[model samples]
Target: MKRLRIISFVLSTIVFSTTLLTTVQAQGDKKSTAILDAMSNKYQKIKSFKAIFTYTPDGGKSLKGDATVKGTKFRLKMAGQEIFNDGKLMATYIKETNEVNLQDFDPSAGGDLDPTRIYSAYKKGFKYAFLQERKEGAQTFDVVELTSTGKNSQVDKVQIQVNKADNSINSWKIFQKNGQKVTYKVEQFQPDVAVADNFFTFNAKQFPGVEVVDLR
Candidate 1:
């Protein structure tokens, strides 16, 4: 199912739970570099934002989803035939439980998944090669591609859209060397939010008949 596939990529990785792992290994140097430090003078610093997503698998109808990231944590909702009907479903394909529940799994849930892990992961994740420059919106963006080494070698090319005005990242694309591609767009952003700790914990008993299927 198209919807399920979208959820798979989003849920499996968790906004680079493992994608940007290799972001720290390389820096841009002219020629093939994609890092645009000069253009990041503005619009590169995102405190928080919301994004409406459409996945183009070689360009079909585009799998739809919405993602909102603030600080180090984010919420992603994908359009699923069964779950999207009401548009309230947030997928949780828990590896530990092997259950695919239509429930929002807070990034902080279960053993404290530090929300900022994704952003800072690249600080020490992997190696990279920067590419050319491109303009998006009012900002000039630099594209930095990543190469996963050692155990991460299978990660293929991960392209990051860097803000020229600021060092912050604008968007990123991940493509498996085998050919699976995923694009994440930063729609709207804010610096921080007042989120309750309870947001991540949900008692399945509250939702009667919620589909719970083991994924592992």
Candidate 2:
């Protein structure tokens, strides 16, 4: 269950990170919105993309993961597990157990972890503003902050850093209501990568002696 939860959260994060500024509310400052718009336009032109990221939860060790996304399909490799979602079905393979769980994929089913809704979350429940600009060596980043307005919101705050050079996302930090924080940093991003539809499907022949659990 814990692993499933992690996968759900990470999957949602990957989608949200990739489409970060698309649906931001109009309440944000003009500078922030302008930066976001540029970033959105940059990503929208790409048909497919691949990213390598580092995930670190509060009080936990950092883990490195890579994900490839093509439209609604995605393949994620992280923490000894590989998740494949071909838009309609999802398969989660655990390396330790040599087992794969297959189930129907519904982006709208998981509340809070729903990738489809996460794109519009900021427009509804959060207030956003331009925080500041930070310079790291030769690169400049625009930082934007979003605060949850609802008292019952699971997330308290979110901070995003966008690279000024190419309008790409650099990293994001999520602060939960329970005082826990999760950070995701993009190590590398490749847009317009060549990939086939079969790349997002799970093949049984790839793993010998693997147990398959079909829950769909």
Candidate 3:
């Protein structure tokens, strides 16, 4: 369940842009590439960001959590688990087991589950296209669809909704081959916030009776 949740979260993480649709082809798609590039550029400008998100997997109840990210470092907390990555090391704490798994931070590790790597991954193995425009209340959004180029990829497709006004990501949905659909809605987002380094590190002393397993 833990692994599935992490995978679903990773698959659902995406940002979109409002570039015009100029082509339908996914590979070397001019408009889609431009939109993705713009979104990536915007992300580079943010010093830090925090968001309250609700993750709902198909056939499962929704889970709420908050995440703070600074560059490649992030701290993600859900109901039973919390993951901390301080740009060099990563620790995953499981509340049920009262255990923490520590490992060296490999940018390539965790595949899509690694929050640090998702933005860049789109450029390589996927084809993207502008889907359509959508609106929710007063805010307008631009939707984009991403399809994996690899035939055997676990993710079938991903849809991202970007706020047209602020160029912020509103939400994303991931479709998996195994009939699981995971959606992540960004309820609140604050950019350029000051987050301390300590927030992304794990302190074992804080967890009494917790077993620390160092895999590094």
Better model by lDDT, 1 or 3?
A: 3
Across 2-39, the per-residue lDDT of candidate 1 in tens digits comes to 44555544544433221122334334355323343332
Please give each candidate's TM-score: 0.59, 0.87, 0.84
Superposition TM-score, candidate 3 onto the true structure: 0.84
* Candidate 2 overall lDDT versus native: 0.78
Q: Which residue runs does candidate 2 get wrong by more than 4 Å?
A: 15-25, 110-121, 149-153
Model 3, span 1-216: residue lDDT tens:
465356335523533111122233336467667666666666667778887889888789888888888877788877678888788988888888898888797765444323665554566667788888897899898887888777767788888787777666778888877877888888888887798999999999899999988887
Instruction: Put down candidate 2 lDDT per residue, 1-216, tens digits, no spaces.
Output: 688777766676553323343454476778877776676666766778888899899889999999888777889999899999898999999999999999999865654434534444556667778999999999999998878887866778888898999888898888878888999998988888999999999999999999999987
Looking at candidate 3, the ten consecutive residues that score lowest on lDDT are 14-23
What is the TM-score (0 to 1) of candidate 1? 0.59
Candidate 2 lDDT for residue 123: 61
Model 2 lDDT at residue 69? 82
